[model samples]
Target: MLSTNSTAVAEFQRKSAQAQAALEKVRGRGTAGNGATSAMVDAGGRLRDLTFAPTAAKWGDRIPALVLKASRAAEQDAIAQVQKITKPLTDDPRLRQTLAETKSLLSAEEPGKRRPRPKAEESEDAYFRNFSPHDPR
Candidate 1:
């Protein structure tokens, strides 16, 4: 029994090490305002670098917003990188089952605390029609 437990623990450690290595390889980059601003984030979603074009400061009051947008893009890029690397592991049946179980447990609520589900739009066309003029679609 002790041997079995020890083996399981060792396997877990090995998997954990592999995951850490993959995460370390993750590098996310984000750009805003047609390359006017940019940011890079690591696997842990920590900012690694930021750059701005010479004209970036001319935007004045919009500088903060531009920086925020670029930062968000970088964070998303990092998350995508991590997801791409871990896809195989995440696709495991055991992991899926565990995630589903955990989600259900977390979503459970008392009788009076249940939230109403939002109704789906009756027409998909109506949803698309609401798109802004600037939308590519």
Candidate 2:
């Protein structure tokens, strides 16, 4: 029979491979300057595709700027995609750290940015009332 240590190692290796495979399925795109141009990339940081609006061609002289913007966007997009793809693995600290590192690199927007959090429906005191010893059973 295999030792517990070996089983754990085997499981870790399996999970790592699964995480990488899940990342491969994540496709991300970054659009710049109102989506006039965009870059597509997979979570692996490999460029996949690009898009340009008709007017974008006129900015050929600014290709370097455009490329930089698109790359940043692509990186951010990839990070987001990878996060979603690997949600299941996030319970593992090592996996979560790996994903967070990518997100830090992209400076991805805060998860709560778009929507303001709703006010607490119940206050702490009220929450305790439900289980408080002071309350009669």
Candidate 3:
């Protein structure tokens, strides 16, 4: 019979290998304003590739801004990929912890990444409330 520690170790190793394989398959893609520039990153948040439209080359000094935009987009993409990959592992506590760590690492460093507030017409309560007109029997 295997010792408890050995069994645990074996399980951990198996899960780790599975995680690595899942990560290899996960990828993110980001695009700048109107696709002037774009970037792709792996689940580990490492840039895999980048592309720029012809108009992007016109901005010499603005390259930094464009790159930052692309990087932010790439980070968003990675988070989405991580979310999808973690959904199936949600039942495993250890795997959930790993996914939390991965999410922290993949968060965007740039400002204004937060989604804009919804307009007045988009209120959730407004949509969910029942509208009853006056009725006389």
Candidate 4:
């Protein structure tokens, strides 16, 4: 049992270090308005830099929108990079199984599928009361 605990702790530390290293290497940049605006985001999706071209003023009221677009693109790029870096760890069977189990426990319904509401004749309290802690069905 002691060895198992130590091994788990060591694995956690190793993965944590790897994740930190991957994050440190992340650098995402995005541009919008035909290079009129650009944004750079770090691994944590924090804006690191923003710049606008001399003609950016020509965008008028649309300048904010352009900046937002650039920012979003930069964030997406950062997320993609992080995913790439963590692919190996995420692909591990143990991690996948844990994620699957957690998702199942949190949400019984699949994505984009809504559970049907109880009939109008049934009171909301009664519907909830019917749920048993031991039985999820």
Candidate 5:
């Protein structure tokens, strides 16, 4: 029993370290304003660097808007990077099963008692692949 508990703890620690490392390794970049502006961001969309092309001088009053666009792009790029890096963490079937078990143990309600979440509408390709005249939904 003690060995089992210690192993679980070690596994949790290892996963946590992996997540931290993935975040630390993330680097996202974005460009906007017709290549006149560019920015680099880290995990939290924190600005790491910024650059402006010679054409930026011609943009004049448009520089501020270009900067905003570049920053927003960089932030989105960072978010995408983080998602790609950490996807495996949540994709593990064992992790999902463990979470369900933990929830069942901790909650007052009966196991598997939660309401079903609403799913997004399927894409046309998916719908066509499983099409049935009687099944409109």
Candidate 6:
């Protein structure tokens, strides 16, 4: 019985190391602004590159927004790959605590994966309604 448990633990460790190595190789590519803006990020959500195509000239005033959009897209891509790497490990009942620890190491949330926010568009009583349409409060 002891040997069986020990072997299982060793196998789990091997798979964990393999997954970590695979995660290190992940490079997420994303583009936005009609493909004029591009970004790449590593599995840890660090920006690796940013570039703008010649077509970006038409977006002179909006270039900053394009950059932000592209970066977020790249980060989301990295996060997705990280999730894929960790999925099998997380499914193991004995590894639940490790999953929580892994969540802390991630720099960005997976876009569109967060819980729905309370609707700020749903106004309060007319007398109490504020002017901000986007405010979560």
Top candidate on lDDT is 4
Better of 2 and 6 by TM-score: 6
The TM-score measured for candidate 1 stands at 0.56
Ranking 3 against 5 by TM-score, winner:
5
Pairs that collide in candidate 5 are none
**After superposition, which runs of candidate 4 have C-alpha atoms over 4 Å from their true positions?**
1-12, 94-137
- Which candidate tops TM-score? 5
Worst 10 residues of 6 by lDDT: 121-130
Query: How much is the lDDT of residue 58 in candidate 6?
Result: 94
Q: After superposition, how far is residue 29 of candidate 5 from its true place, in Å?
A: 0.9
Segments in model 1 whose C-alpha atoms lie over 4 Å from true places: 1-16, 94-137
State the lDDT of candidate 5 residue by residue for 1-137, as single tens digits: 44654565567668878889889977778888789999888998889999999888998998989888998998998999888877777776656666676676688666679755445434655778899999968
Candidate 5 residue 106 Cα shift, in angstroms, is 1.2
Overall lDDT per candidate, in order of appearance:
0.78, 0.73, 0.72, 0.84, 0.80, 0.81
Cα lDDT tens digits, model 2, 34-125, are 66788988887788888888878778778668877997889888888787766655566654455566568667677657644445745655
Q: How much is 20 displaced in model 4, in angstroms?
A: 0.7
TM-score of 4: 0.59
Give the candidates in order of TM-score, highest first. 5, 6, 4, 1, 3, 2
lDDT of 4 at 121: 45
lDDT (Cα, 0-100) at 22 in candidate 3: 88
- Tens-place lDDT per residue, model 4, 1-137, is 44654565567568879888889979899999998999999999999999999989999999999999999999999999999887767666655555566677779778899777777746766878897888977
Instruction: Give TM-scores for every candidate, taking all chains together and pairing residue i with residue i.
Output: 0.56, 0.51, 0.51, 0.59, 0.67, 0.65
Lowest-lDDT window of 10 residues in candidate 1? 1-10
